[model samples]
Target: MFNMSGLDLMVIFKLAGIGLGTTLINQLLKKTDAGEWVFYTTTMGIIFGLLIVLQYVLQFFEAVQTMFTF
Candidate 1:
């Protein structure tokens, strides 16, 4: 089962915020002449998501090291 912890929830909230912000920006930019805003927001979201994943990945590696080390 995928149980969520406080830190997990926080990460989810942060990612959701990023997605919502990007969506809002994309919607607003759709009116003007700049059609590339959607792509910009999408790339930004991907970058932010990757950053968050990397932080958790580092934590996971540290935990594994601590567990295996006597």
Candidate 2:
């Protein structure tokens, strides 16, 4: 009873990639002495990822409203 279109899968993959990349970058920065930048990097990554998902979330709500409306 679940539907996942190609676009949805792509967004999921994109989020996964962002998480992986951010983790790697954070580790690299921590090893170097740029620990301060790690927090910003992680925060930006989360914000970016949420922005990517937000579009779909809004669309889902719109779809539900449309489906329930006469």
Candidate 3:
């Protein structure tokens, strides 16, 4: 439903990197004796995931606009 010619494997790699970074943060926090860090780590991960997903949302809106000639 959207033009994905500009999207490629690199995007997937970036997302994976985000996930890994979040995992590392979680692990590091878990080791530091700071329980609150766990919540922060999870929140950061969710934010990052949402940011990545937003790209697709923007693309979807663009596709719809193009289809409607608006």
Candidate 4:
């Protein structure tokens, strides 16, 4: 059996929402011939997503450290 926390679920949802929003915006930008802005928007989305995940990764490392007591 595996245990999943609310934080994990939230992280997944947050990433998914970012991805969906980015895709939608990208499509809209393309349609409107604003291709130049698409790169910035996509980059911002990826950076934001990575920042969210980075917090969890740090927490995971701390937990592992405490578990091993080293």
What is each predicted model's overall lDDT from 0 to 1?
0.79, 0.86, 0.84, 0.86
* Candidate 2 lDDT by residue in tens digits, 1-70: 1234736578879999999999999999999999999999999999989998888777778778888899
Instruction: Give the per-residue lDDT of model 3 (tens digit) for 1-70.
Output: 5768757887788788988998888888888887688888888888987898798889989889889994
lDDT of 3: 0.84
Off by over 4 Å in 3: none
Lowest-scoring 10 consecutive residues by lDDT in candidate 3? 1-10
Q: Candidate 3, clashing residue pairs?
A: none
TM-score of each predicted structure versus truth:
0.77, 0.83, 0.79, 0.83
- What C-alpha lDDT, on a 0 to 100 scale, does residue 18 get in candidate 1? 86
Q: List the residue pairs that clash in candidate 4.
A: none
- Measured on C-alpha atoms, candidate 1 has an lDDT of 0.79
After TM-score superposition, the amount by which residue 53's alpha carbon in candidate 4 deviates from its true location, in angstroms, is: 0.7
Superpose all Cα atoms of candidate 3 onto the true structure and report the RMSD in Å to 1 decimal: 2.2
